[model samples]
Target: MADNENFNSRRHVMRVAAGVGGAALAAGLGVLNAHAADSDGGRARRHGVRTYVLVHGTHSAGAFWTAIGRELALRGHRVVAVDQPLHGTERFVPAAYQTQDLRALATEPSPVAALTLDDFERRVTGVVRRAARLGGPVVLVGHSMGGVSLSRVGNAVPELLAHICYMAAFCPSRSMPSLNACAASPEGQHAITPLDQLVGDPEKLGVLRLNWRTSDRRDRAVFKEMICAGYSDVAFLRVLEGMQTDESMTAYDGRAVGRADTWGRIPRTYLRFGKDRTVATELQDRMIAEADALTPDNRFTVHSVPDAGHLGPEDPARVTEMLHGLRV
Candidate 1:
């Protein structure tokens, strides 16, 4: 995090997203101080103060949580929105992407195509360990595909995470062994995905790449609907600028089940995005139900954001109020 060169490079890539939504998430993670080295990072909650470690979803970066991170910070909570692999600071922008060369973009090989769930787990684990040292209870929050990382990290260091919040994210367990399985469930049938705008072949390219910068108006409209519906055109476009084009299919399809004795033991919460077209509200409920059934005693205390879309034009105050309501 002390690497200023990488930080500058990340800023260069984010010029298009103008706002780049949550890239400031990395800004807050600027450096780790003495508290990081001396603390064990796995102790249980000791007070009312809370440290939030935000994890972003797939084909996206931690910048998506910019406003929320700031809001949490302003409310006196420590915020560390860690940049996952192939995102934020690690983002790789293909040359063809800038040229908008369709053929080249489709066939061009990506450096992140080979990354797996293990890569994501390792990256987040290190960050969470450091975050636990900063203060009170560590409330780890994940959005969209980020839910998988929450589960894996929680299982690995359940003692460190005081609470895990899945904000309309995949929480695979029991019969649902992976995120892919959860996506294929009957409840996920209505998801408005980007399959039509996808580039290349997942099987051949080893990644799921989208043409997020598409010039086609129809494609852009669909992207808006799948992402931040009801938000202004300008808001949607700003989010598009910060968006990435590729995600690791290997990681997307990897196992993400949380063990009962580990992840299940931690207090868990779920915030359902009622207007989520991407994940579908039905699927969100299903994941909560499934996980609750797996651990009846540790059932998720669910909440709802009825007006917000998937990657929202966030009502930070509303979300923050809801977060503060968590019993954990």
Candidate 2:
């Protein structure tokens, strides 16, 4: 009679477990196993998984995170790459940029020109919220100019984040605005491509447009050197193909200095790209230092990806390893 009762109880537990989702079932089993182990006074193991929200940089879209996102997903992690307003396919271009047609322009009046940093923040924040619904708070990651949006989101919703990570990204402070921060750093002047290279007049069009299809070999060479030095010609062209032609100047006008009370409370990490030419190592360090100063009591935990460039998707293995190691 005792053996029959135990078998009936075990069968009932299995039926209940089968009704819940696989993750819930696994969690339930983990808890039961943990309780069994703790009968001997052992501690329970942490069981929750972290989600990541990746924000892209200037002239790029969420597709920029394709490689890295895939790798993270393969490692049993949740990933969401955000597409900033007026960037990538979201931009208002008359013709498709993939055609490599330099003549393409934004003839029609479009709202993309009016997009601001706040708009970007809102979009990213929405994505972060959705990611939070999936499991737990996210590890927000941003690259290059996208860091500005990430900072704004962190400031706006620090509670929804587990950790904020900047990869060769700009993390501005109250004292140092975005444009000013770039100008103040020695690497900013040395490593960046000149603004004069832009194709269209910002005053006339209200947007900064680049001719990614420019047939000028010199221009292509300079662009490659500035953004992706190690990429092959075909790979560089593919990157350009994925880029948007028009970008809102308003997005770059101000700094995204997060609030000390809110953003400061959240844990932060900075991954410096040692060989980054676009946002040089010196400039990256300056921004990191300024961010540290802003929240002196809760300074960022800094790391380095030696010889890494500004593009995160190019090197999946190293980025995946770094992200996998993050603990919240």
Candidate 3:
């Protein structure tokens, strides 16, 4: 946690997620003001990894890496965690407001056709280009959506990655709809986010909506503990406040159709969380099988961890161990 002033700059809206209230959000802000007043942790070691950007998954923020970032820094790795753009707006747009937006979208015919394989590859290539400018070969550790994004990146620019790792990832092979893969296997079937809870329409393609608003203390507690447990509360809430519905429908809807000609060129690894409630071991193996079958000449490895859920990298030591061995 940095000094509180670092977090107090008034944004467009007040914090609205994670069951936080004005008092709780204020308390966290106080903590941050005190922390940021100090310094940004410590400087990265000279000639060490110039930067390591860790991208988070859906419904997540950069704060998810509190422990992981600290550990990597101790090992002299400069860590930068990016809260991926879910909704582009900086202000919190409540469902009531978003409803009007959705209604408008629903009434209008979609301007574009379904996303093709090339579109997926292009989105990923953009991420890699950004990464390369930050520093060459930044190790990519993607979980869920981040994982899916990386697959595209790996396909388009294998030469740009120092290492690629997917943690309990979301992967749909070419010639298959993402849902087809999910429903095709038991593990995948069990992992679908509840329909009502899903933030976007699966059929309409590019629509995204704010879907989580339950006041269930248990659910909120579980989310807080599992994801942002060690993060600065103010920072965490800022991330939550900044959170928006993700564009998964477009990213996930149809068959990828064309085989990625790029995966054959990258070295990749998969960490399958054995007890993963989301992406399961069986599904991971299926994905691995598909990957291997597609690229017989490529090198790939899968490691298993017992008891860890979908967010396996939350275990600092385990993730560090796995990440330390990878190379460009």
Candidate 4:
């Protein structure tokens, strides 16, 4: 039951984190246009290849990967970006209106809502199933808390992934809680504190909504820049409003304590983003260490993108090349 509770809480935090971006962030990034393929959406047809499931980090929705997905598609890879379940159902949390919802949760004073780990696992399993149907086994790529989600999934369904890549990811050590990975790392320690205050409860579904909360005016501006570049106020506010605190935080932080298992069962890769004020490089290495130690069979590869930060997909070419290199 304790394990169950931990899984549930952690999943909520990760899901909400993945669904962070609201309308403004999406629009500001022009994520739609950025991904417009230079080639026809159908370029070279490569079938029977592994599916790539791209997951975004905190304050970023699955739509954040649209550009990268299109690029991968053009290269003949079946790719999908999941719109996380942190904000409830799409009808209740439609893309356009999601920003408003995020704002309310972030600024509104309220109790945190919870989700069962079974429910979180079921949802992730569905995502894995969808990716499998799209292609074959999947190459799962996750950033920030998204990485934690992948860790949880990797433990539960190692067979679903052909490759698991963590980008500046947070990882739980053996017998340690997920929070330990963050606390021990320079970036994680700096990032979590202020963020914890804004949402009131880091374990709640409202945490994602408050990602933009920074007491320091300068830091807040920097956070905004790191989150989204070139956006209108309408879009920014929408993203702000659509935030939620994921229930998955428990699963993530708890992994550090009990030492979340299942690393040796699958193939893994690590993409360490550069200039990232969020999850720093040292933390990324720690995650790699934890992954390797958990599964002796798990091969860990690391790449550092010096130009990119937490938002590394801004350059589709670099990401495309990496995906191409992973081709089977």
Candidate 5:
């Protein structure tokens, strides 16, 4: 269904990404990420607009980037926040989940079971290729599991991309061929694995299914601690309501290591989140280190949000500033 999608709905994204209003965004944000209108589009942006291909992680849809995309769109950049395979409008929200039927949920014949990382690759690659045709440089942004698709697509069509960015996301290479490998590393020790929240065995179901709506307080707590660490109960509930119940296991197991000549040629940025326990900060550092080792000359242009977690909804305007300011 994601046949060469583009940001035809960018106007809509701009409105939403401008979200929370100037009031809420100004509430607790610190000096650097304050909500004050920081309108100077940096470097490449001061010259001309660039195309941004946004890839969301598992359990969420294109709506996941609505707020962020909205900000980029307002800055006059083209934002294509893609819905990865079996995600977004294409998501198969299981019936068992809605009815609170935990028993049925465990074995609900997941339509996403047969799905592999190949499906993800096909969707993102098509979007990136189409964006390339629209002219100007294409900047690809990936978060969490979305990074897997980013690496695969980068390998498939390296020349089309001017840059790739990972925000508290995985960046697999020879040293880390897949996300599981990244988790198995020593630095990954600090991460909060989703194992406790799983509904069924991955081998049995061929997918890593979650019950994000589980009534269990402990499970909810684990998810909150891992994802939006400092959020209040009401805030975390809003986050939970948007989560999907299943994700392809093969997507995580897939060999997404970028080719040295292809993916390695493109410049990259790793926006590390200091408070991200889901994909621990140390683990993020490990990924950047491994990637730099793979391509010594073209290391990541690193940045950090010491106060931000995995989902920096509080990133204020910093994310928009960095994205708008980026150059090849």
Candidate 6:
């Protein structure tokens, strides 16, 4: 009966409509955090301070979390933004690409192309294990495709994590696995034309590479609208500057299914990017709903930033407040 009551309560929370505006969100967050603090007394005693492990998405490295990591550190939290292997180290620019002369561009060779989802999971797990050795609470945070790695780590090592936070990221469900999540969806059909901007054929190159420095004004506009519409032009450029041209296609092929007994045991939060175009609002809701259904007893504590795009965390403060509010 108690389990039934908890499941019903979670269903109600998940069904509540989002897009309530910033002021309301702030108030809701305060209440949610207060409840967490009250209920997690033992957790607070066991782990006095929290360490955050920030994971980046595709085409980017740990540098993507520079602003957020700085903000977290200032708030008296230990933070580690992981640079996924081969992201900043490999270079393979095709001469035919429009941005061939851009010195910042790099692509993966065959060995780097061999990287899989397991490789990323291992990388994140290593960080979490290290943070645990210091005897403090650990929060694993992931953005965009980084959520895939985060979920795998959560499944593999839930005992080490105090919380797992997904920032407008892909949280796969039983019905829609990782590979399927990357496929076109009704909500994301018009979100972005990343394929239209592809510089090389993945089949031929053995990897996916993007020309981030494309000079086309239209391409830039589309890129911004889809991924970083909330960012200033200068800020968007900085993000592009930090992006890698190469990514292992195999990385996207595997599934990161969160298990009911393992991954579902950990506390989790989902921060909806209300204004996101890349992973459209509808799709985010769908993912949240699906995951909640998969693990009804461990439903996400959801929050929203009403005006945020996919790259909203570039501001850091938006996420800092949420992180600060989390008892874990």
All candidates: CA RMSD in angstroms?
9.4, 19.8, 12.2, 8.4, 11.6, 12.5
lDDT of 2 by residue, 1-328 (tens): 9968655544332222110000000000000010122232212223345677887777677777777777777776667777777654454565535564544453434476788888888989998886666554478998777778778888888998889998887777675565435544454654644343455445456555566667878777766766777867777777776766566666666568888888888888888877777667887788888888888998888889777666643657888788778878
What ranges in model 5 sit over 4 Å off? 1-47, 313-315
Q: Candidate 3 vs candidate 4: which has greater lDDT? A: 4
What tens-digit string does per-residue lDDT give for candidate 4 at 69-96? 7777776666766555553222123232
Best by TM-score: 1
Q: What is the lDDT for 48 in model 6? A: 60
Candidates, ranked, TM-score: 1, 5, 6, 2, 4, 3
- The TM-score, computed over Cα atoms with residue i paired to residue i, of candidate 3 is 0.63
Every model's TM-score: 0.86, 0.80, 0.63, 0.67, 0.84, 0.80
lDDT of 1 by residue, 187-210 (tens): 765676554566765556766667
Please provide, for model 3 over 1-328, each residue's C-alpha lDDT reduced to its tens digit, 9 standing for 90 to 100. 4534323311101111111100001011100010111133232222435345565555444555556666676665656655444222222344443454545433343322243435545644665566566443467676655566667666666667767777776566753335334434554544423333322233343433333333556544444443344445554454445344333344444343214466555677887776664555676777777777777777568888876655563346997777766665
lDDT of 6 by residue, 112-131 (tens): 57789899999889988977
Measured with C-alpha atoms, the lDDT of residue 277 in candidate 5 is 75
Number of clashes in model 1? 3
TM-score of candidate 6 to 2 decimals? 0.80
TM-score of 5: 0.84
Off by over 4 Å in 3: 1-51, 87-92, 95-124, 133-136, 175-180, 183-186, 196-211, 217-247, 254-261
User: Where in model 2 is the C-alpha error above 4 Å?
Assistant: 1-46, 96-110, 179-187
What root-mean-square deviation over C-alphas does model 4 reach?
8.4
Badly placed stretches (over 4 Å) of model 4 are 1-46, 88-112, 116-118, 179-181, 184-187, 190-219, 225-262
